[model samples]
Target: MPPATPPSPARRPGYGERRGELVQAAIRVVAAQGIAGLSHRSVAREAGVTHGLVRHHFGTMTSLIAEALDTILPQSLRRNPVSLLLADPGYPEEDLVSWIDEQADLQVFEYEVLLATRHTPELRPLAERLYRGYEDSVRSAFAEHDLPAPADAHVTLILAAIEGLVLHRVTFRRDDGPTITAAFVALREAIRLAVAADGAPST
Candidate 1:
């Protein structure tokens, strides 16, 4: 019987695939228990892999945290309403709300990391990159829609408002869908009006 075809070598995951799994596990651990709970063993347990395997993929916890942020930042941006609108102006608000609901854990993870930066100076750069990613996405969305480039302060305020809304929704746990959706809709309309007003010629 051809020696049972050598059992097909047990079909191990590709290197990149395994690394990705570890990163996702790290995010989940941080999301559930905050950054203080993240360790090689914790991630290994979360991913159902050996701790050595996690270390092999990421030499240190810092590396693992960085990779987790790197992986999640794009994911968060891609699902962001502003980014979605930039990609497809017709993207539904309902869909955005659904995506937000589904990604609550990811949002929690992000905030955990951002807060951790206060005590972990090494993480400050990663936090800066995270904010820069959001800022770039917002700037791109504004340009894509022909809105005037907002001042740096205005962009910062926009990010603060959106981030605050997301935090309130995820943290409170009781914020209803309609309320969250309405808040997002109002924020988007407000942004458009503000940008248009900035661009309009003085009467």
Candidate 2:
């Protein structure tokens, strides 16, 4: 009988420094090429690594794209949306609205991913997972304020408005910030009223 060859070692990143570098490279690749532009070879070129290494680190383009979105997307929200929302226990209505307006105007990368999702069915699941994660994150923020369980419809609207604002901003170069702020302000008030009606004493 012929001798069997040993299997190749798995290609996951080593951890700590290298892993973060690999992820950041993937983010740039996504930013440049859109999610559809993500390929092991393309990402490897972007990261200045061997194609085999990129595959080893991320396994597949889908995983790489998902990770890219995961790492970069939240910071856009955390830096702008979440940070502003949490900054003041008494966050003025205008500050809250302006923050949302700013986020909607910035971060065109999300629009790229959303467009890619329409063509790549594999991406849809990852996109859904990411959206759900955002919804949960937003919900947790409201919960911290002793707010009621926010209605799913409102969350959906917020997500849609954000997406629409990005689309309008990128496609027509139009400003949708004020419109987005108006919608968000309405949702915020609804949440606050619901929280007050729930009668949970604010901590």
Candidate 3:
């Protein structure tokens, strides 16, 4: 008989992979039902695993939430139009709309967590840390472009404007890509104008 085929590699997910799946499931639950609806059972159901598995991976609700935030923070920054624009000044506004459309659920989940912070003081730290991550990315992007980084307040305003646009798009289910692209273009121009005005020689 032909030598037995090498034993099939273990098909089971590793510990870290299972934890990541649970975190993604948690995000989906929060995105669809808000943070109040998130429970180990809900996430386990979404992930096609048992609640016991979720608990084994995350140990506590707060820990799971925090882990979800940690996972999403980097994702948010990477997918954020501001970060994209900073990294590629010539990145098209139309692409911004496309990116938003593609990541609408993730954006919604981020907003849910942010809104939750209003009544859940304990979550404020995580939310603040998330914002700081964005701010830091903005600064780094500015530096990479050989531009002076805007003040923290300016950075905050810029990010807020982008977030507002994203909220509007996702909330309204706006499918008018051109209209959204125009808005993003306007925002991008406004940022450029602000930087230019700041750097201009004194009158």
Candidate 4:
């Protein structure tokens, strides 16, 4: 018989769980009560952990807020998992609208954080970075469709249109109607045209 290898070292107890719990708890609080409601005690209570643990782990409320915002991406994906990145060949590029709809709650959570950032000088940089990430994803999806590289303004325009549609629907639409769907189709077509090279077929 081959020589047996030594066993792997045991993992630290509850290390990842504690941090993840606090971050998720923060997200739930923001999602349910808005960013204005987030506090050390609130998140601690949500996570069922000590207030000092939250402070000891994050050191400050802003740091905790940042972590919560950062977590939305992964949390959102898990709930409404995307099958492919825009970089993948044969990916259903048109399905982007549907995908965004599935992640609506996550988007709402992010928008709350963004609104909070305007009043928080320390939070602006991270929020800007987060938005740039959204832009990059948009650019990638555009690239996958063989669309030409859009200018920064064009990227911003597309992102603004899509996010606005989402926000408008979430804020106003209460019934199970295709209001957002109709708007998204028009927005998607507009984006396809915007990314097309001059004189390319608009179809």
TM-scores of all models? Answer: 0.88, 0.64, 0.90, 0.76
- Residue-level error in angstroms, candidate 4, position 51: 1.4
2 or 3, which is superior by TM-score? Answer: 3
Inter-residue clash pairs, candidate 2: 11-56
- CA lDDT, every prediction? 0.81, 0.62, 0.81, 0.69
Residue-level lDDT of model 2, residues 1-203, one tens digit each, is: 98898999888655666657777776666656666676778767877889887777778777766776676556656643432343345355455445444554224455666678888788888777777777887677666655566667766665565455445545554565566557555655554565455556657
Range of the 10 consecutive residues with the lowest summed lDDT in candidate 3 = 80-89
Question: Residue-wise lDDT of candidate 3 within 68-177, one digit each (tens)?
Answer: 87887777667556656755547888888777777777788788888888888888898888778878877777776777767677788788888888888889885677
Which stretches in model 1 have alpha-carbon errors above 4 Å?
1-7, 83-91
Residues 1-203, candidate 4: write the lDDT tens digits.
Answer: 99999999997548777888888788778777888888889989998889999888989878887776677655544522112322334344445546666666567678887887778889888788787767776666556556576778877887787678667755664753466656655665665566555336567
Candidate 1 has a TM-score of: 0.88
**lDDT of residue 26 for candidate 1:** 90
How does residue 98 of candidate 1 score in lDDT?
Answer: 79
Ranking of models by TM-score: 3, 1, 4, 2
